[model samples]
Target chain A: MKKIGVLVGVCLSALLLASCGTSGSTSSSGSKAKGSYQTTGTANSGEYKGIITNGRYRTSKSRGVGVSQNTENMLNLKSFESGLTTISKDHFSPKSYVFQEGQILSKGTVENWLGRKSKDNPEGLNPKDNGKKDANKRNPIYVQQIEEQDYMKEENGKLHLAGITIGIGMNRKDYYQKEEYGATYTTDIPKEQMIAEGKKAAAKVLARLRSYNAVGSSMPIVIAMYQQAPNDSLVGGTFYATTVSNSGTQMGTWKATDLKNYVFPVTDTDTVPSKNDADSFDNFKNKIQNFFPNLAGVTAQAQYDGDSLQGLNVTITTQFYSETEITSFTQYVAKAAQTYLPSGIKVDIQIQGSDGSVQSFVARDNGDKGFYTHVFSSY
Target chain B: MKKIGVLVGVCLSALLLASCGTSGSTSSSGSKAKGSYQTTGTANSGEYKGIITNGRYRTSKSRGVGVSQNTENMLNLKSFESGLTTISKDHFSPKSYVFQEGQILSKGTVENWLGRKSKDNPEGLNPKDNGKKDANKRNPIYVQQIEEQDYMKEENGKLHLAGITIGIGMNRKDYYQKEEYGATYTTDIPKEQMIAEGKKAAAKVLARLRSYNAVGSSMPIVIAMYQQAPNDSLVGGTFYATTVSNSGTQMGTWKATDLKNYVFPVTDTDTVPSKNDADSFDNFKNKIQNFFPNLAGVTAQAQYDGDSLQGLNVTITTQFYSETEITSFTQYVAKAAQTYLPSGIKVDIQIQGSDGSVQSFVARDNGDKGFYTHVFSSY
Candidate 1:
């Protein structure tokens, strides 16, 4: 847990002052006060059925948005930064998380599930405590939205349904492989207890939504977010079976589920391709994996919402690959997506650049997600 | 499309008779008619979950005579001897699918969604068809069981439902790196014709399960598989949904929903261990990528399922350095797994030997469903 050389913050004099003191252990002041703050998300479009988008259970030639089943109906993110100074008693935010860059974060999830409370009294002058209703439990559902540079409780809102909301930060770890000395979130909470907390989060989000009268009388929804699994087994990412809030907030980010792989809709092309070339597939997988250094491979899982009679806003986002060799590969996979995917499935692939710039393409019979810049390396 | 070599079938005298006094092109029908096969697997005693005893999904913590996820699931296979044939179909009854080697498969899933024909040619099969009930369209989920040197059908059986069921599989293809050949799957059934066929299939599986409804009510199951996607957006994996079956038999198998990633359960313990006194998570990811001759790193964007639960079931599967590594990293990965993963989650690590043999470890909490043996690579 000892971070080595993080000088991103600290002025020269501050650094010297700290080192000059006896014992040399710096106190947690001077640096920007950081705190874990969460925000919710809502989709700008309609919902579809879950299995329908899966490649195997197609009833129509619909386009698929790459949303995992485990993700709840809405998208939720909570910042894991450590320094926090309240804008007011009811408001607080962080400059950044306390962990190191590229340091696989496991505790963020445990923290997300278990929302923070002031540890002192329930609810008094510290609006952060929210009247001490449930101080000890974590929902594991973190929804982050960093839209406004300044967030005021009355005007600068915290949740947005659509319209590219920003400010949220997320980190993904690996799935198939584990890192030595890597940290992961582990909880002693029992399964039944976790389930109970999941249910409560769902209810809390629902209540928050209803209070805003944002309930559009639509079918229930689910919220989902994908982060790297520190390892495999317990689960990665967070899934909440939920509905959207009219206030543009993710209503309920719940507990994890065990539905990573399910038999549902599969693509028509599952039949070994004309070439049936394993070499090709490996090449493609590697190509994409290169960009998303933490990712293992690109798997086309399906998403479906039970809202009937409407067009869906489907989005398929990809992770960053490691090298240029894979950059082309990942882009190729994203581009080839236009061919193998169903017609109705409006496909778009995006890669978060090293500097966090997003490169994307939306594939269709007409519009392209901009997958090809024409660079091939298949030797 | 040119095949490397053909397996001749006719006797030299017969071949001469057929060729008469012609040139050099010769053809044989024997080799193709009955290629060879092999036999190898593990089994446990008693019943565990919906799986058979000591079935594939079993770990030392519990003996999971669980349903067999696949007659074959350990990946990285590479042996092509002869004489391999199905000894029996549904060897343990319940209609079909019961087998000694397959333990991860869910019995309830098999009973309810596999290998059954509809009693009433149920009219109005939903989305009308091109209207012909082609037996080829009868793609029922089928399982070929191995019996005493013969293949037989296990009719009239049952299913179990203890809690939840999970199915796992591994895939390798160079598609992600290959852009021109990328593909995907879709769930849109635009014609409305396949819907009727799908309904028919569903009805048969439903009926069969009703017949064996005494069990399987309490179980929630998930079947999982991995597919390598092209690095490009427009290509690789399937874009359309598909159901697997050939006429009449009605084997209830269906494909998986396509998503950007297929999140598998795993743990932080899945990290690649440091050897020779070295340690760090980033280093671990690098090592994993190096292990796979074609894999890059781990998968990203996973969604967890359990909210209030204590320990989640995460089984980190593979580790490699990159997509183009030799086997050294894989061996090191396997060794690291033994040291890192606990007795529970069950580690099934594979290492390819110089002599065309595969060394593997099916480490469970305690049970033989876990194995330490050698086999040929098939994946």
Candidate 2:
């Protein structure tokens, strides 16, 4: 009984150290309040215990903390994080598993893996440098970033790392400046090569994770492959494929994700696969343009899986000052959206005045009839 | 009795048209939900009924929508809006007034007001164009943008526009490109002149507001002057002065708001007025840097109201992949912040890994002994 009590104490301390090691002042996790499992202090009243985050945010091991403020990379960053979280839901159900940030992968290990294969860093996953300055000859940095998320489950009143989701962000283009503060040049990587390289990188990451004693061979892992947008693109990239290894060090059979993202009123006809979606968006745009003659521009970004549209994010730029005018215009937009745009897809519309502050927004959930609208007041 | 009823019906229709004309679907304002006055659908349990926005966002009348993605003006944009809002709190208390977007000033009027004063546009507030292409002689568009916010009060079971706050954003430097996709040149405006011009413009704006029947002589107006940061600045501008004119169109006594914003680890000694505050930040930064050897940079944006510091927003850039390291480091940061920084000020610290994603944050309110830290997990 004494030996058993000591072992239990060790496990409990380890759990506490992992969850609240930052300040050690926050409320403890798995402190059952009534019937529900309580975790973080975040207000959550549901069956699924809210994510017990360690307060560590994810950053790309290679990119430094953030890109330049001027870069259009923020869009890609948002998609990469949110899209990975969405993919995590498929394997790690929020109802059964509690979300925790991946704590096992140390900073040193991730940094080494992101670096180009070198003599000193033999574990590097990226292609080795060949001492060539030419864009065509030089190998691009195929694997840009890796993000890991761990799902926890309570067993014997203690949270256990049940499942892990890994997101590998692959670059579609490699940008390099010849000199400091000089003009930037780009080298494009073929889509097929990027996908192939991503899968290989994912497998290597999996193998490395398995080497850790905590993450044994039996641990279930889900690896999602993301193709990042080019540096100049306004919209972000999407996940191309994903694989789920139920219980092994080896990766499972790859499943191609038909997910795609396209800016509406696409300038290039070849970029958009669906002409019907383009036409539908055009109708919506035209309706809005016709209503407001002095509109600066009306643009939308649509996401699709296979042929059907999954979501649409629209931005309308116009000159507005009055409450009555905004209200009347918003009503017109809602009516136009319902009549012209494709239904059965989640849609969000943001109306920004010439000054760029959000004037109003119209949002509709998937399969919803009525649209929800809100106007922001400056006062 | 018949004439009185007709007049009441007209007034009621006008009120409805002003408030809920957008969709006429959401709940009406001043419905009085139990003990509170309900406005929008947003959940608000405070005495303030919340803002009754008309659903129109503010954009720069001159700039047109958002600036280029690469420009560092977003920092300035945030300060201009939030700073103005903060200034408004002094005059328009949430307990008595409901916030609303400006309604009387039409888009055409604002657009015209932002243009250069000429024979065709007599009401233009900006200096008339001299038809000079030379940067030295050309009249700069000193009046960059204008934001108007209305504060409403409940009277006789109806909302009335009682107060108005106008934020006049003046440019410190005017950037002009000779040709499309060409080299950009800047013409700097002297600080003394910018302030003088802003005050002059404020009086003009006041006179215009008085012309409107809804905003007549009795309506109180607060106009705050903002000296915008240059195009290349990492930090934003600050509100230099503000004047509140009560019950008349004439300008009131201008009060110099000594509110200033500065980037810490000061490279230029002349910029920071208080030397002790600078040394305090250095001590705090050094403590964290000494503890962690590998850090990209540690910087803070400190806002000071006169000689006293109001708030500190610090960002620490480093490489982090593990939750344990983040937790440990966050604890150290919290300790360092408490020990080294100013005691009676709100401080927020965000730690970002090399890749640019936030690892964790440590925040402490004024007069608080302990800090609140949150770690965001990928899962």
Candidate 3:
């Protein structure tokens, strides 16, 4: 009995040592297991168990020892409001916040008790909550400071922004500090949800601008939502959605007036349509090839409004076997272009000789059921 | 004595097993030990212990069982000549080789026995050796073949080759084939040595091209040598040397006539001078700043011919504190530009108001000296 007891004790000691080794390995590896967000109700409820503090929401679980406390212990609504006030004092002008479409909030309105401190009182105690209040008498609009950046694409000396990205948090370093937030990080939100939120925010901003009558009505705007992550940088971010809106005109600043023009250079290789409109232009060129068997090669330049075809300029080089056939070839191409091309597109055709001389013709849509008519042609 | 003998036998068996295991490990690991090149004489002699065959030299030592045999066994001069002939037949036109200054070689010079089979007779068996030579009687110029490709740099819609690249040997796949020559890859050649060889080759080619009177005298040509590597591709290569040569006109075609033009748009940010001639333009801008204390910002568009400054267009935006100060400021800037700028460089200055109206002035070189004379002033 004594020997058996001694063996059992030795086995138990070894098991304890193994358990301790496993726990030590976990901490030394620095691999923090990611925590999953749990929905309180429906899967797509968009609400999680967290409290919004310091411009971001924090969950209730403790990340690890010496890292972070539970959310309930650290969160303070009054302190958060005070921090916001301090930030606003440093970065924004007094009365900068717009309320009720076009009215600027008076100084000290945000500091007063009227601004809701928690979700319990979404709207502060105001007589105007009855929905009959005048636009001038509403509470100040409160937001967690908006950050905007232009996303530009430049080609051939033309610079334009496709959209504007708006971030909803402070700079990356401040948001990513492990001492403050522990292992907490932002994740990607659904695009449609972000778009809906961006639209709501943009509507308020536009209404305020309209009340002040500051900007032109025809100006275009793009509101994109960026969920701030720990790794966000100045030039890039995790974007959720981009929504384009116009103030008054349907064709706003983003709409380019005409397609960009290009000129194809002469080369020894067989010429083809530019890659920008290869499908439609190649089909047209092939049809013309069926008409003129003496054609050696074809080169084309085109203009487009976005991706839609606007106009085409084509040059055809021939073997120059027969001078008499040149007139018939030009006529045939002009007719073929008129027959094949879509309505409202302008076509310019040029037949190039072996010696580099070019004969030019222009084909235009007649607006008579997609039939094309030729303008003056020079041979 | 019997026990001792048995012990010795057991130890020998263990030793044999260990040796076999080591050999198995070497083969299984696929570890190839690199071998050093054997020099024939002094390090700089450019000769190695190898045999020249198939247009490439090969070493004597075997690379490994599955790798390749040494260079001596794989190299064959006749096979190399045949390969060249085959490549020429497929890719080159008849009479493509240039023999004498401007003379194209007739069809079968490469295959004829009179042509030198080795480097000992570089020009082959000439009639001069027999003392019956005539300049007119010599066969038309012949070369194995000459190939040319453009090395292009594309920017801002303009595509140009600063130099022309000439490659020796067949394409990459043919050169790198393991079946033809085991372990005979191009990586063994050092980059600097290849560059030196390419420079020498380019100089010879340029001299030969200059001897030919067929091309325009003023044409500028860049001859860059490319040592064909086993991994040669369209987008990238291991370049050796690039040398520029001018034809009869010393000025050469490479000298661009006009400064590349640029346009700068007004923006809220402070504008700097364009990258072309930034130093001189910035100096002139600083001097103008000394004259105008209320200047808000300055944006400049300038033109340059290579590194030389040609013309400058500057737009200055300033606070409209006083109308009288504006005229004096314009005069000061115009005078400063004339004094600071180099002769023959045109300077156009424009002062813009907050509302976008501009006052213009033109500063021209007087030509008598460095003095700049203002042609016109508009407010």
Candidate 4:
């Protein structure tokens, strides 16, 4: 209740100064605002809690246009954000908390934090630039972007900021040029070094966030470190590890999430972590490919927790357009998925045309007895 | 701009009274707002001009959660909204106008308009109820929803409401029951009758809009009529016709857009308007299907302007996952699209996995010499 008073006071003053103009704060009656906002809540977790947002769309203060160069990179960023929230829910119960987009860190503050620590920008999280043209000597941008997601608890009718989760998107490979229009050079940051740098950066972010009066002193901060996939990767990277600091700026010991993603029917045997998962996917792929002669390609992104398969997302490219054909094919796919796929895991299959329009969908949640199928009706 | 002064005055007054809390008015500096807002702009039209929004996401006043019952219904609603914007470009040049989501119609007003006319609700646009339970005697609700898009022109850095486009989504098939939770019955509305009812509703909407002080007199208004597709249909309905009222509340004659969409390889000969288009699509499909043996499906959605082909959206579902195979197949697809498909029309092809993840993209703009292709890189 006291925090609400302070937030309202800050908002009232900001409104008068016209400084925080439409910052999407709690002062706004959410129902009156425009545009639909949705939570990427999972059904298995009993739904992600409260809508702290005004149900209005608000662009991130920094990188409103987005920094992802392509679709693959974009997916990587999305997965990192959503995956972090999932991890946070284990510590911060969704049933007891309200979800809100990061608002504590101002655009100027975040921009400064993402930059290389220089004489002017002392608050920068990345290593100070050496101003060297050589790839080996030059300091790469280890921390690409810092994302904050605020968690709140409702007291009375108002929501109070209770927790903060920070997602650090660290670059695995840095691409840069020595001079303007010069030949580009690539610097591959070792995974160990990236992890170390990411943790250090997160600690700084936590300290900075704690300095803000809005973030209570005893607030638990969750830090998720993600290794970004290369720009050309078809699949995005996954959150490898996370840490939580219950109080002050010091973080707890890092806990290995052991989450990994792989393209199914992986050509390279060395990269396949689990032989069982690979064999299962191969069987599923063979069954589907044999079932339909006109099949174009069957590929999947299989997610794993250590050696155990967690979920599989499969796409079946087809040449069929008729509703009857799609319907029959979808039924066959559901059967194949149930029979061939690894049991005790969530499997989602999509049958699409060459144009990428989904013709049918077959899905089975974890522990489900059978897959549910739906074929799109052609008008 | 006097409009700026008026809007600022209105916003300031609302702020003082704590009434319009974060209405997302022009008074707020857009760069400071939260969440991304995007225009459904097309490339051919030079680009839908102006960022009239604060770039913050705002939900629709009436149906923020949306009224679409399923995925099919959602797509229908989306296509209807986007198609209306595309049609609007013809009358209102995108280069000269700034697009903003409908904001003038308050939530209460739209709710009343969507309701059936009764003794309590006189402002209701639908027909009055006679308290009859019979299907034939009972009055079916015709108008489902009204969408308003404001077009603005900049003068001295501030945007002014120069024009407005109203989209009327009319029900083609009304499903209802005599009593609550009773046996449902369907009422099929003829195309002629739907159009008449849509136009009648548009006239009323225009009249009401004219009464608003924010909407300047002598402003041009474009009204588009969209027939809602049946709930089961995969594809959404298109905008059949549109009319423009250059001045005052009087509308002009309706002009047929002549745009129609069809699923490729049509088995129903009567529905296939152009024999040449069907032959071309068949040839194209055959070439791609023959090029690859493991293809799941190759389907296309072709849009026609009268009898002439306008654009083609093709989806090729594949079983191949190898980078080399996808690249080689994409090249063949590009060649097949160019050699077999109809010329002088834009075509877009997507090679995707059974999970619907896009693997490769092949496209050719109108009057292009060759198709451009890109295969997604495997990580």
Candidate 5:
């Protein structure tokens, strides 16, 4: 009996070992987990559970009532708005404002209503106080404008903006047009200003969670910033920035995989002025234009390795009367280009004749008075 | 005891099977046979089973006479001559002749002696009766000449020959000066005539070899004919033709792996007269001298892919007083080259001025009335 017990024990141990090894090896290489939320209570029960969605926090109980799909959607919307408000306040400051998609009490909505007058509503709503009971029944998420802030502007008869973006929950429908989201001013503001505004707006986005007792169930929220095109007819804007709130334990694991930093324009006020090699090459070409009276024009292309000028190739079209003239012209052009081009910039000059003759010269600058030159000709 | 015997038998069978498998697998991958010659008889014995030295047959018998180093050397010399004579007769024919080295009895030797003689021996030795017995004592393999064939000639004071080469056994020292063996006639003789003369001389060489029976053994022989240089001082001649004799069974297998054939001069008598493209280009340049008065010279290089003319590159160095003149000159040259060059030949023309400017044109023949022209220039 003792021997049998020992044998049985060994067999059981082996089976356990085998099972453990198999499970450990298969998990990582197997299927991924589905669904973002963890259910804590029975469906539709008054019992509540805290849920984080899109980085924002909410609860399953809707105002102390049973959880419903509609209440879940509303909580999701509020969570999204809470995340946006955090972003706007923390980052954008004076340059940006946060808004809910359906909140009718927002200043921007009231202004919009006052501005658009129709035949049926000849008396436009007052900007200060529209005083309508129906307003409370309106969607709870709506555009909000900060004090003394105008979200839209016109300049030079063209509409422009810093940028705008909008995102809907994975399970909900988008209620607004793509253009109604993130936007910038219409004026030709400096790139530096625009980039500053964009960065400020990005910083205001909160990577946190918020739960309103007025709403039900925990909800997840994701906020994305879309960049607006200077001209809508040109190209549709793209999502440029993103942040999440109410992710709870998944907060550390949830990665904002795609984000782009705004670029500023180079202005005279900047610390360093831009130097273009192509512009310099064009200037050099102009200097040599008069040297060949018979030449029609001179064109040049400059090559660069990063910001350092590597080489310049120039071509001129002209007519040659004799071999002597061709030689003289080639020498003259070579000398002129050598003198006109910047030091250490290698230049190649090619001249083509109307009668189908070509002469080419390469002048390499060694940072000295004279240039090392090589000439090639096609006869 | 029976059980033990059965176990032992089984073990023995397994061992046998393993050994057989190993042996069968190893034989194919084993080392290869070494050395070039097959060993027949015991070494250093007067009784030799046939041995092949340098691809030639030899036996242990040393002529049955006392072995002397001088006799051996003479035999070796004789064998070499036999090879040459065979080659001359079998290949060169009436166009060639063979003369034993230092053998004044041979017509070609006597003539050479006479030709080199000054005021004292100007009459030269008689071809049949040059009684100077010392001539025979001279190295028997001294120098052989094929006759009626002045292998070398002076043309306009320049020594010239067609070209020729000869390679002897690996270990033997070359007895004759390189120039003495292969020669070309100075005069412009038809290739066919020279070949005929060489053949005849070769036949005579064979006849002379049969007279020397002192060697008392048949020998394998290889003969090589080297073409002579047009001007011996200008360039060394190259190998031209070859033949063999007394090679026996080995003749078919013994290939002249290094033999090079003579390139017959292209002459007017041939079915297809040779046209020197360089000369043609020079002639064309001369014809267009008047068109570019300021030009120094027009040089051209022609390229051929095998026998097919491919292209010509021409360069003209000159001076041009005005652009108009340059254009006209370029156009004139392009048109002239297009008309002068052979059909399907592409021509590139470049004109360079004294002052260093250059004009180039490419005219490709399209098998039409005009050429497809392109112009390149440097101004």
Candidate 6:
């Protein structure tokens, strides 16, 4: 009986050790089980599971870690190559979330892969967590930001190729038309559908634009703009990229130099979001992340590297408003050109007031870096 | 003696008949043993021999004699598939043309295509010469009438997939400063070379544009513009096209209501034997034929057809002024457009004065019941 008891104890200890080894390394093949999303609305709902390899980092919170994680944990950063973990369109473009994985990831055993880590150990594993609570677990804060600048140098900067657009609006048209005092005609699709189409269109346009290299310094690209109304009458809005030029043949401003430059209230009116309504910054970031995760890095603390260019101009526009009631609006559209924006370039921003007055802001200093100069009075 | 004389006469008659038969049917091959071209600026050159599976036509005096030709003459009408003959640049895109042996070209040959006539005969070899003659052995006026129409359609209407920009300029430093001093910089390349490049760029751009379908009735297109000198410089022009739009919250000119109300130029430009440079036009046309010989018709009445289109807008700009002097200048840019433009479409010509004032003329009707409107002088 004594001998039997000793054998049983030894077997239990060995099993425990094996289980612990499985959850320690992220780069191990099948090391992290795939993750799934259970979503509502336009989002997809299902459980996902996958393994990470080649320098992938993972967090138990970002994806459901398998019950098999050991004392140390690994994270999945495999999205850099094989693409990213995408959620169906439950959220609109420009969305954000504090991602969490419900459990430890399960990576299948690869003795050879794990054997290359440390002096005392052969298995390559992520360093152990500094004895902190596992709530934040392996999840790292991913900062994402986006900006609009010039057209030519934007592609090389971020090294990212964007081919997706996500947005949300009223999926219903009756309510939207009613709220807007009966506006009609535009897209052939219904309001909600149109909004969805618009969102998809934007994504498609960007994807295609990224495929080619066009740098016409002659004209500032002009386009049409749209906005969504809240509720069943709408889903999202749609717009087009178009242009009209002056006789002199140079684009003086984004609004166009051939014509007097000014920002005016949107000719058409639509519903205003209630402040009580959920603030949607998180949702926006979430959707955008689906297509362009790196955009969150737009928040850069840039310093002026003193320089002069033989022939160069830097132009960017940003709009920030935190207002509850949007009685009126006007949209200024330009292609996102930050991907290749030169590092040391002068920037000019035109900030407009509700009354159509304009203020030109030139920022060669770090202090002036931020979103567009135009903001609503209430915001 | 009488018997001998009779026998001799009989033999002579027999010999004479035999000689006549030999002269009539010559079943053997002629001296067109091979084909060769002087190596020069013709980017592409070749030799091919095709049969008239159907009745075809030839306009070039050098082509379309009998079926046994083995030289350059036998290669006309593009009867054969691959031996020789320069194909258009369009054949190099994602999609290309596939021709079988014995197929006839509509304009370059005697008949439409082998067997494509009212009668169905794939091997029909009957042809026409029209017997019309000019100093160049082909009617220049007739060719102008036909090719100009085709040039407008394929060159301007098709949707563009993608393209590259040939030239880029951030600012007008050289020409602008010099225009102030009334100095016009002549191009090192002769007028013939400039015209040739312009034509080449046009064909290439057109070929690339044909691969895509219109986007939401907004066909993606590239513009191959001849950026004319501001009466101050002679520089080769550039071409640019777009398959993608800049990522902005706007739509481009497709949204402009002006499309519905817009009218075409009213009159056509005049074309006379240009005084400033008499040989320039013939040389220009010859340069084009060398590259695309099929563009010339068998009757020498060459006409061009837009590859495929419902309606397209074309604006042509040409000058009849010498590089050194501006006298005897007649605007022939939009001349053919007025007489040949189809219905429901607009094509035009614009003339610029020494001081930069402009006048416009509309395309003429194709003589069909359908007529295009000319809104000349409206601008």
Best by TM-score: 2
Deviation in Å, model 1, residue A276 alpha carbon = 12
In terms of lDDT, model 6 sits at: 0.22
> What is candidate 6's lDDT per residue for A1-379, written digit by digit as tens?
9999999998996785455334322211222223321111111122122111232212222121111221111111111000111211122121322121112112222222122235554433222224433333321111110101111111322212122211111112221121255553221234454434433433332333233343222222222223322222111121211122221233223221110011111113422221111112122122222221112211111111112221111222222110100101111110111112222343332223233222122223222233222211100
Q: Lowest summed-lDDT stretch of 10 residues in model 5 chain B?
A: B39-48
Q: Candidate 2, residue A213: CA error in Å?
A: 13
- Which segments of model 1 are wrong by more than 4 Å? A1-185, A188-192, A202-238, A243-346, A349-379, B1-379
Q: Which of the CAPRI classes, incorrect, acceptable, medium or high, describes model 4?
A: incorrect
**Which regions of candidate 2 fall more than 4 Å away from where they truly are?**
A1-379, B1-49, B52-72, B268-270, B289-294, B323-332, B353-355, B366-369
Instruction: Please report the candidate that would top DockQ against the real structure.
Output: 2
* Candidate 5 structure quality by residue, lDDT tens digits, B1-379: 9999999998997796566445533331111113332111111121112122222222212121111212223222222322333343443332322111121133433334323234554532112233233422322221122211111222443323221112221111112222445532222434454444434444334344334442112433334543332321111222334555452222212333222111112234522122544434544565445443333566654434345555555667765432223433444455455435454655556676664545434445324445433222211
After the best TM-score superposition of candidate 5, give how far the Cα of residue B71 lies from its true spot, in angstroms: 52
Worst-scoring 10-residue span by lDDT in model 1 chain A = A79-88
Candidate 6 docking classification:
incorrect
Q: Which lDDT tens digits does candidate 6 get at residues B1-379?
A: 9999999999997796566445422311111112211000111122111111111211122122212221212211111111011111232221221111111112333222221223453422222233433222321111000010000111232322222211110111112122366643322334444444434434433343243232122332222222222222111111211122122212223210110111122113522222111122232223212221123210011111222112222322332111100111111122122222332332222223333322222233223342222111100
Question: Each candidate's iRMS in angstroms?
Answer: 24.7, 10.5, 35.2, 23.6, 40.8, 35.7
Residue B143's lDDT in candidate 2: 85
What is residue B347's positional error in candidate 1, in angstroms?
52
TM-score of chain A of 6: 0.19
In Å, what is the interface RMSD of model 2? 10.5
For residues A246-354, write the lDDT of model 5, one tens digit per residue: 3331221222322211111223452212143333444445544544334346765443333455445466776542222333345445544543455575555666666
Tens-place lDDT digits, model 3, residues A268-336:
463333442454455456654543334446666554444565555566766432221343344445444
Per-residue CA lDDT of candidate 1, range B1-379, in tens? 1232232433654575445323211111000112121111111222111121211111112122211322132111100000011101112222332222223334444332333334433321122233333333423222211101111122233322222212211122211111354543222222233334433444443333334343233322222222323233221221112232222324336553432212222245532221111222233334344332344333211111122111111222342111111122332343333333322332333333333222222223333233232111110
Off by over 4 Å in 3: A1-195, A208-306, A309-379, B1-282, B285-379
Cα lDDT tens digits for candidate 2, B198-257: 988988999988989999998889999988877766567878889999967678899998
* Candidate 5 ranges beyond 4 A from true positions: A1-379, B1-273, B276-283, B305-307, B355-357, B363-379
